[model samples]
Target chain A: MTDKDFTFTIDGASVTAQPGQTIMEAADAAGIYIPRLCDHEGLRHQGSCRVCTVKAAGRSVAACTQPAAPGLVVESETPHIQAMRKSLVEMLFHEGNHICPVCEASGNCELQAMAYRLGMVEPTKLPYLEPTRPVDASHPGIALDTNRCISCGRCIRASEDVDHKGVFGYCGRGIHRRITVNGEDLAHTDAAVSDHAISGGVCPVGCIIVKRVGFRLPIGARAFDRQIIGEAIEEKRR
Target chain B: MTAPRKARVATVSLAGCFGCHMALLDIDLRLVELLKHVEFDRSPLNDLKHFTQRCDIGIIEGGCCNEENVHVLQDFRRNCDVLIALGQCAITGGLPAMRNAIMHSDDPLRECLEEAYVLSPYVENATHVIPNDPALPLLLDKVYPCSAVVKIDHQIPGCAPSGDIIYETLVQLLAGKFEGFDPHIVHFD
Candidate 1:
């Protein structure tokens, strides 16, 4: 191992990482699953959703953005950190009209899976925003329903960075902030079903959906139903 | 030692589709076993309209969409020792809460009524008059989860939580062993 590769402890487990690698990247390499949303593999880390918040060096930080340091002690899976993550996930649920039962992304949704993993039975602590976001069903093969959008900007990043289409963008501020297409509707934009943003499993929720392919996987057979979120990452250790 | 008194259980459906009630029945033959521990007090299962006595447990299947639903839920809270919100409707207002998004308008209830009864081509209202009968229960400004109206001791979140979940919850609650549901079995859909 190079001199630049140093050791860090995540939840008391020793992990090795290169100098420039973020905590999330290093943790993944060590098969330590740091719960996160909006921080997809190969995509630029946004750290918008703080589901991966952890205590590093006695301070709370988003693991996805925080660079790993030698001898750094990171606390994850602790009650306080998990509680914070649960609250963040709950707030995301409250902020959006995420009707999981009717959502196309029901069982396959990362947000829903995270909620399940975090033991958030319901988002009862916060009032539902119930924002009347627009639904763009103009595209024959794709649909954009902003009601379920968590403002993670994954679609925005995937479209711009990967597809080179720049099909998605953001508008407004704070609670009013929402994802917007290039034009009036999704069809007006150059978004395609074949685009990496649509087909690449970028969206954590049902905001962006492949129309007609919904419910293709039966209830108990769907992604999260079969396995918990981050289980695959944790399985990497074996 | 005397045998423990069977828990007096009551159930009600307010602004829900009664699918939860159907799911409760979907427990199939296990219900016969469930009956061995709990006795129905004021439930549709036995067509009991009013509580004969204070109930040990109450299971509510929907959110409050109207004044009457709130009244019924409040009555349930008063008459039962423990209250459980039994479905997505009771927990998060579910499908009916879809109307809550339209509450941005000045008269959202009226707008919703007009769209449904007066404007929609699917319905044939001869005079295009919105229903305003005094006998009809007044719709609330917005649908509210059960916790917003009355204290909910516990919740089972699903469109209709599977029969197994309902059965397990009921059995555990009856045995006083319900810590919480296993996360794997607790699904939103």
Candidate 2:
């Protein structure tokens, strides 16, 4: 007798996945897009930026940071997750300077794109402000504009683990807190800082802009700009 | 007639671009809408020409470097009903804080004034020359982020935070419904 195929249901949609596949993997296979930040497929999960949070059996968890499980009822964009993410995005927005219109990252900025997708039109209600933002022009190929920084820890983490250059370490505190480069003394000197700190990459938002790479291409022609982040994320699952 | 209540605020600037302050002008259309509910005093915005009394809200930009930023912070705490850091300079010290790691003084101003301008005799004009004062405001010996200064109540963050956050903050304060966040970070040294 021929045996029936094994399958499971997620949010009422039935789909088949490997016997030990995780919920996230199953959902990815089924093409149910779950928004996330902090968990890059190319690297280890840091579980930062809770935007990818989803509800599984009335519990909230990060899809990117979590493994897929079988037969688990999931809710990707529940109100709680959405609200939490909206607040988180707002917090990140307020924590660092992430103005989309003027930022060089523009369409390439994940934070900006996500804010739009979530319809988070209102700005943060906090009245805090940082003092002066230092522009580090030390690295010939990169510039760090601290004002627009979100401090997702991607740069710091990338430096320590991936790039093997611990040039950037955090300093000070709230509103006053910042990411320091090589003790913050002599960054924009020459390629001296870059020579050592040039891990996989310095920053995610072009924060550590490559000096020689300036205006290399038209604005619309950049990596993330030409394609919608959501679309790209969904495409990856396929 | 019921008298209008003043919205308390304080303004400060540390190592900053002042770009966020400029963005406030982008809200030209809503200026009148805002003045209706709030008042501005002791703002570096009105004119750097002089200092005024503290009011309901205190807004600050720029990062703290040397001595002046320190005094300004004290003044805001003493006078303002609420002290709000306005932009990246104040929020994360934006780019200025990046300099705190090192106090290297290429002092771009010195080069532009002492070397570049004076040497360019071919193009130098009477008005184009710079003063030899080692104290010119343009010559920042060192850069700093504002967070190193006084405690900030809430941060608007963009290089200059968006006018949207600024205006929203003002409106909320005017309505007497502002719930600000602590603009301090606890460092474990």
Candidate 3:
């Protein structure tokens, strides 16, 4: 618990970090991937999805948001943590219409990759809730399918923070909450229709998709198809 | 005094493109090797219209979109010890189940019928009349995934699952090794 050395042991591996860095940041720097869905490196951490929950100092905290302290013992990838992450993924599936077969983001989706990483081949024990959310295809380049949205707020963060467009925002509350555009639909929003836009490629699932380019990358060639997400991230680190 | 044991497998396609069955055939020379361990019962592969006896495994390749599909799926559940939902159609209501997207609207079946038979540009003047014969199996309001209708013991997911995947899954099932299936063998698309 001493603040002298800027280092912490994560899953027994000592990872050094800066003072203000989060557990997730240190893990990323050391190539120790904490499985995450909502917390993308390019965007600010929403701490919405608790997929990156890890035991730190005997308390379960989201690694993406929890600051790393010296001598902090962080335990991730334990059977309990793995099970918790799996259940969270299951909860996401239950909440949304994530028919992975039909979803355009099946192969490349972070959620799907996470599920694969956790060895979730079958559907979760939770009852599937087939919510009939509207698919806004008014935009020429993008389609917003609310059914597959996991409410990670990545699009909300990317739109407002990164793109600085403020086109996307959260609507409703709890289970009824969803990502919404400021105007009539995506067509009327200030979305620039580029990869940099929040609604463009920031979506973890098949929620906000660029129209016509869904299957362009092909199945086997996609990011998660050839290598697991962690391997890809670690490769980037190397 | 002893009997030879072989796994009996029955397969059917409901509201699907039959691509899954094609994937099965894509096993090619391995089909001969597979036949050594398993035998086909009522399946398009065997050209059997109905099940003659109880089966060890039932491979369903489509979602239940009509009354006939329901009847057949129920029959599979009754006759088979293990029912495996194969492909996207069987597991998650593939392309055909896109019709269920209209579930939000009232009289979605009617809307779907009109859109398909009458309103679609593909339909011509003479052929535009909606088929409502008593002989035809009635279409369900929404296409249901196989798991929604019956207990699916194992699911092989894909638009049309790769032959290698099907072969691997079948081999695993045949070997009584249910757990630890290769993740690469089950891509969604």
Best by lDDT: 1
Q: List ranges where model 3 is wrong by over 4 Å.
A: A1-5, A99-103, A123-125, A198-200, A234-238, B1-4, B125-129
> Between prediction 1 and prediction 3, which has the larger TM-score?
1
lDDT of each residue in A82-195, candidate 3, tens digit only: 998988987886677777776778888998888778876573345456666788889888888888889888888888888788888888998788888899988888786774
Model 2 docking grade: incorrect
Model 2 per-residue lDDT tens digits across residues B1-189: 988675644454555666767868866789887877666665566554334654877777766654667777777767776677666556444455444332233444354445455667575656666665667444345444444456555556454455665677677767768754222111000
Task: Rank candidates by DockQ, best first.
Answer: 1, 3, 2
lDDT (C-alpha) at residue B16 in model 2: 62
Provide the global lDDT of candidate 1 against the true structure: 0.89
lDDT of each: 0.89, 0.58, 0.83
TM-scores of chain A in all candidate models: 0.96, 0.74, 0.93
Candidate that beats the other on DockQ, 1 or 3, i.e. the better one: 1
Runs off by more than 4 Å, candidate 1: A1-3, B102-107
Q: Model 1: which residue pairs collide?
A: none
Give the alpha carbon lDDT tens digit for every residue of A107-224 in model 2. 4566665655664443344533333456777555567777666665666666666666666777787645667776544453323434424424335554666566555656547555
List the TM values for chain B, per candidate: 0.94, 0.67, 0.92
CA-only RMSD, every prediction: 1.8, 10.0, 2.9
